[model samples]
Target: MIELDGVSFWYRGRPDPVFADVSLSIGEGELVLFAGRTGAGKSTLLGTVNGLVPHFTGGHLEGAVSVAGQRTDEHPPREFAHLVGVVGQDPLAGFVTDTVEEELAYGMEQLGLAPQVMRRRVEETLDLLGIAELRRRPLRTLSGGQQQRVAIGSVLTTHPKVLVLDEPTSALDPTAAEDVLATLARLVHDLGTTVLMAEHRMERVVPFVDRVVHVPGDGGVVDGAPAAVLRTMPIAPPIVQLGKLAGWDPLPLSVRDARRLAGPLRADLPAPAQPEAHAGAEVLTASGVVVTYGQTVAVRAVDLRLRAGEVLAMMGRNGSGKSSLLWAVQGSGPRRSGRVRVAGVDPKELPAAEARAVVGLVPQTASDLLYLETVGAECAAADAESAADPGRCRALLDRIAPGIAAGKHPRDLSEGQRLALVLAIQLTAAPRVMLLDEPTRGLDYTAKAALSGVLRDLARDGHAIVVATHDVEFVATTADRAIVMAEGEIVTDGPAREVLGSSPAFATQVAKILGEPWTTVAEVAAAVDASAGRVR
Candidate 1:
């Protein structure tokens, strides 16, 4: 369904091609997965299929690219809308309508689909994507995850032969991610719809794919059987690592496969190490926190307290008030009634500079914090604002994610790289309390590990940290405590292991495979080593 021959593309700029001498073919009814580190041109490749690369994006394209027997270069993106359905990373940016129902039907209307056909397809897509309940909700008011569902539904209603999704599940909860992937699987198997997906979270999509297209950092591509490719990939999911450690003949990609081999390993391994509780004096406190917009209450009365060295994770569905509470605590977002004290002062009452010194927040849209023309300029501005050394912000950015070009525009950076840049800027303030909302949205495993290390070190330095995220793996690795919120109320709060282990929706792959409370591969690996020592 998709073919590229000697295809190479590079933006009109100073240097280098994004892809050079690349050739690939994806057959009809096949589910292909594109895997690579962040900013490795994965999205650029996906764009080429629908002619968004050189056509809409203003890049130079060489060689032939075709989808459904139509040359992409010969046709505009709209010309192939009936054949190719593309959903990008930021669903909100692509929205043209205010309500979910209208957004879904808008594409069909453009195609001049008959009203009866459009109505039936809209209903089918809404049901297919499990977004029926959200039909009448305004697009602007929906959470990130809900917006993603609506984006996918908008394209699926057209019954396009090809579907290209970029990180479709990044904003979704685990359950929602699974449901969407399962629906895609059915489309590939039952409807013969060709699907191509690019995702950083390999564990979720790798198992279900028929082919894996591995894109190494050198602007190249390699394709092979999923097992063969994943085995050699430097970055892999936890289960793959577990299989490597245990010397399993074939590495397991899914929890079920790993669980089959986990029987003996689970019994032989010792108890996993537990993080020590934080007993330091509270560095941040929020009492009776309530946030409302118009008639809608985003957050109800909720109380929260954080110790200096605590790593607290706020977990909940999208729009569960996690972001509201974090923003309120940071003394920036609207709060109807609440008292927040950080470092012995209410940040809300302090001057802007003083409040920033007391608390730091890296919001969901990390790019909002960046306004300079280039990375170097942004770093210089951060240093100037914090009154730190000229190179301090640059140094921090290097530590977070190395090798970012200082001359490149912040807007040009990949989602993950932009996030790292913003995070570095926020860290320069050296606030006593820090809050990050959905920081892992675009990060790969390697970047996430680096972020976890950074956050863990900050916690050790007695910085109170609160992270509101859907990345359970990140929470399991970084957070010492977990707080579950629902409709603005704290439902469960306890040790990270206990909270993540008991809930099926929030448990990590290790916890699921072991059928126990362990939350990470490190914990399991440590237990196995201890068991080996005892046996010896």
Candidate 2:
């Protein structure tokens, strides 16, 4: 379905080529995953598939590239539209209509499909994407995940033979991301549509991928079966790590396979530890919180109480009111209907200085808060916001990411590094209640470990921490409690392990395999050792 021979590309004015001598091929009905760090040419490589390389993003392109039996350079973008459907990282940048139904139909209408055909295609796609309820909703009103699903559905309606999605789930919550990936899997299995997607979140998509194209930053690419290529990469999912360590051949990708492999080893697993009882002290509490748009309610009659020395993880699908709930607590969302007490102060009613002093929020888009020239300077400026000591901020940054550049522009740093800067600033203030929204969105394993340590330190120091995130592994490793919300209401609240462990459909496959429900490899190994009468 696609072919690339010795393809090398470089953006204009850049010192080095993002990819050089990269060759790959994807056969019919192949679901290939392209993965790498941010700005490692993941998106640039996908652009080559649908004639966006030399066409839309004008750059030096050398090599023979063919798609759907036609040479890519010879065909215009419109010509390849029927052969390739491209969905970008940002869904709002691609939207053309006001409502979900219209957005899905717009592409088909442009393709000269009959009105009846377009309507049928739109309805089918909406249902296929599990977004039928959003058909009548405004595009702007939908959450990031919902907008992304709509973006894919719009492209899918064109009846393209191949689909290209670049970081489609980057903005989605865990459950919503799973739904989108599941939908893609069904398309590949049932409709025979070939898929080529580039994403940073490999854990959710690795199981379904037939092949993986490992893009190296130094202008090289490794293409092979996922099991073979992933073994040689700098990063691999937890299940793959377990497979490598346990000496399993052809490392299992799915949770069921991992479970089968590790089930017999269950007796060697340690028993679940009993949670320490809470003293019923409220560190952060909210009541009658309400956020609404023109007429639609986003968060309605919400109430929550978080205790000191506790890590609370909020989980839900997109548009399930997770972020809105945190925003209300942070005193930044729409008109409020009730009281939000953080560290015994009503944030919504308190003055700006007093409110921020009580509750510090690390926003989802960390970049929006960063304006300084360097990582060190950014942290220093934030530390200066409340006359926070310089040594404290430096220590926090060093603890989170050692040997990080203090001179390079914050804009030039990786997504994970920028997030660390934001976190470091939040820690300097030492608020009694810390609010982190999607804190682990772009973290690597090492950075995630560093973040876990920081959050754990805060919790141990008796600071109430409420983290709204989709990173299940982070929640498993750090959070003490789990809060599930849906349709503007809290659905469940309980201990983290008890709540997440119950979900056979959603918990980490590696945990299921180890029979320990441990979120990190270190914990898994610890459990195995404990079973062998060893102590850490």
Candidate 3:
């Protein structure tokens, strides 16, 4: 259904092409995943399918690309709208309507479908994506994950033959992500729709996809069965890593497969050690925090305390008050009534600059913090604003996400790279307290590890950090404490291993296969290695 013949693409003023001679094909009813490191041209490849590459992005194209027998060069993106439905990384930027129902119906209306057809598709999509309760909610009022579902529904209503999604499940919680992926799987199996997706969270996708396409940064693309391609791919899920660690032939791609081969390995490993407790002094405190939007209460009188050297993860279903609570505590977002104190001063009473000095935030949409012409300029601005050393921000950027060109535009960077740039900017401020909402949205495992190390170092340096995210694996590796929120209130709060292990929905793959305390592949690998050493 999709074919790329000798395609090579490059931007103006760049000597090297993003990709070269990438010949590939996707059969109908097949679900293909694009796997690669951050900024390795995964999104750029997805854009070529819908003619957004050379047509709208102003890049040079060397070869032909076609979808469903229609050449992308022959027809404009609008002309292929009915044949291809594309969802970019940032869903909010693509929205054109105010309410959920209207956004879902907008695409069909543009196709000039009958009112009855539009209505039927709208209702079907709402139910399929499990967003029926949010049909009347304003687009701006909905959470990031809710907005993602609406964005996908808008495209799915068109009933395109080929669906191209970039990081489709990045913003969704575990349950919601499964629902969306299962719906897509149904489309492929029952309705014969072709899905081409690029996602950083491979654990959720590896089991669902029919094939894997790896876009290594060296302008080469490798396509094959998921197990074969992932066998050597550095970017992989914990299950795949665990399989490799155990020397299991034909590396397992899912938890069920991994668990089947884990019985013997489980017997050789000891129980994971309990994490040490945090003894640092309290750095931030919040009391009676409440955030409301009109009649809807987003956060309900939440009380919390943060120690100086703690990495706290706030997790829950989408729109369960994570982002609202973070904003309230940071003294920047809507807080109908609340008191937030940092360093014995209320951040809400201070000026914006003063507030940032006390509490810095990297929001869900990291690109919102960047507006400069080039990466170097943004880093420079951050250093100046924070009154730090001239090269402090750039140095931090290099440490977290290396090889980002200084001359490149922030908008042109991949979603993960853009997030890293914003993280570097926020860290430059050296605030006493830091809050990040979905920091790992577009980051691959390697990038996430770098970020985890950075967060750990910050905690060791006596900085208080709170991260609101749906990526449970990330929580297992980075957060020292975990808090689960539901309907605007904290329901569970305890050690990271205890909370994530006890909750089936939020547990990591390693924990799910090997049970409590074994929440990460690294932990299991270390335990096995130590056992071997003792025997030797």
Candidate 4:
């Protein structure tokens, strides 16, 4: 239902096009995945479908684009609203109403649908995306994952023939991510909707897609069946990598397939690497922490202690008080009752500036921290705020994520790039205690690896690190300790390997393949190498 013929696009004043000579087509009822690293033009390609590329983004468009028998170059997005429904990566930017129910109705109201019809469609969408409980909640009050599902429901309510989503499951927990993907699959099967999505978490959708379209960041796009395209793709999920390691005839793209081919390899593997135990002096402590919002207790009597050189991961479902606990411990959010000290000083009792020096937090909503127009301006402001040497923030940004255009608006950046910018800005302060909330939401595998390295470096330098996240694989690789929370309380706390390696719901793909305490591809590789050395 969507077709692009020799489409080449470039922004004003840029020499190289983001992508060139990209000819592709998507048939009705097909779910297509756009796979690529961050800032590799995946989002740019999705924009072309709804005429947001040359129309809203102010770019040069070459060749013809047609969607649902409508020419995109000739018609604007509003005219094709019924034919195409587009949801960007950031949901808050597109919201026009205060409450969840109103936001869902706003899109249909714009289409001039009957009030009764809009109400029915709104209810149906609320149930479809699993946001029925959030119908009355304020848009600002919902967690990031809740907002993501709401954003998706807002578009799905329109019930357009074609649905274009950018990282639909990036903010969702694993269960929620699976539900959203299953919802999309149902749309493709029952409603005959054409679904096109861009996602970095390949493992979630690779098994459910009808086809794969890879944008390799070199002005070329490759489209084929999942197995055909994934065999040689540089980036892939752990299941695919395991398939390659075992020399399977066809690369297994899912866990079930990989399991059938993994018996021999798993039998020959060495014992999993044991993680280091950190019992350094306590650098940060939270006692009797109680956070509340009116009648709701967001965090209930939680006590946490962080030692220098320790990497702690706060694990939980969305709205399970992970973010609330992180913010309270950092002395920013509502802490009705708590004693939080960083380096022997009570951060909550200090000035905001001084508190920031003692505890730096990269909030889940990373973009809100950035107000400046461009990356350069944000970097400069961070340096000035921290009283650091000029260009320190900019230098740190490059070290974290190279090739981010300094002149580009922070909002205009990809979700991953924007997160990196905020992280780099926070790190410039060099606080004794560092906290990151959902830092891997938009980062690719390589960017995540780089972040893991950075976090490890900080821990080794005697900085206390705590991360609140839903990404289990990331937790397995980066954190030394894991703490699981539910209903504003900690349910489990232990070594990262023990916590992640034992939980079936939260274990990494590698751990699933080996049925052991393994967590990372590198660890598995080390074990495999050791076994091979013994055999030799």
Best by TM-score: 3
Order of candidate numbers by TM-score, starting with the best = 3, 1, 4, 2
Higher lDDT: candidate 1 or 3? 3
The local distance difference test score of each candidate is 0.88, 0.80, 0.93, 0.88
Model 2 C-alpha lDDT per residue in residues 1-536, reported as the tens digit of each score = 78999999977656679899888878888899987654467777888888888798787888978887898889877788888999976677799889999999888887899998898888888877789988999998888678889999999999888999987776677666777888888889888899999876688899889999988667998888898898888877788877776677778887788777776556656765566855647888888888888777888899899888888998877788887888788887774587887767777778877777888898766677888788778777867886887667878877776556677677655556677778888888888889988776556555677889988888888888988877777788888899888888898889887777777644765566664456556566666667667643
Could you list the CA RMSD of all candidates, in the order they appear? 1.5, 3.5, 0.9, 1.7
TM-score of each: 0.97, 0.87, 0.99, 0.96
Ranking by lDDT: 3, 1, 4, 2
Question: How do the residues 445-520 of candidate 4 rate in per-residue lDDT, one tens digit apiece?
Answer: 7778888888898899999899988888888889999999988999999998889878877888888877776777
Q: How close is candidate 1 to the true structure, as a TM-score?
A: 0.97
User: Which residue segments of model 2 deviate by more than 4 Å?
Assistant: 54-60, 69-79, 171-176, 272-281, 350-354, 365-430, 514-520, 531-536
- Stretches off by above 4 angstroms in model 4 are 380-392
Clashing pairs in 2: none
**lDDT, candidate 1, 412-445, per-residue tens:** 8877789999999998877899899888887889
Model 2 residue 503 CA deviation (Å) reads 2.8
lDDT of 3 by residue, 1-536 (tens): 99999999998888999999999999999999999999899999999998999899897999999987999999888889999999999999999999999999999889899999999999999999999999999999999999999999999999999999999999999999999999999999999999999999999999999999999989989999999999989888998898989999989888898889989998889877778999999999999999999999988999999999999999999999999999988887889987888999988889999999999999999999899999999999999999999999998888777899999999989999999999999999979999999999888888899889988999999999999999999999999999999999999999998999998889999998888779999999889888989999
Candidate 3 whole-model C-alpha lDDT, 0 to 1: 0.93
- Candidate 1: segments with Cα more than 4 A from true spot: 533-536
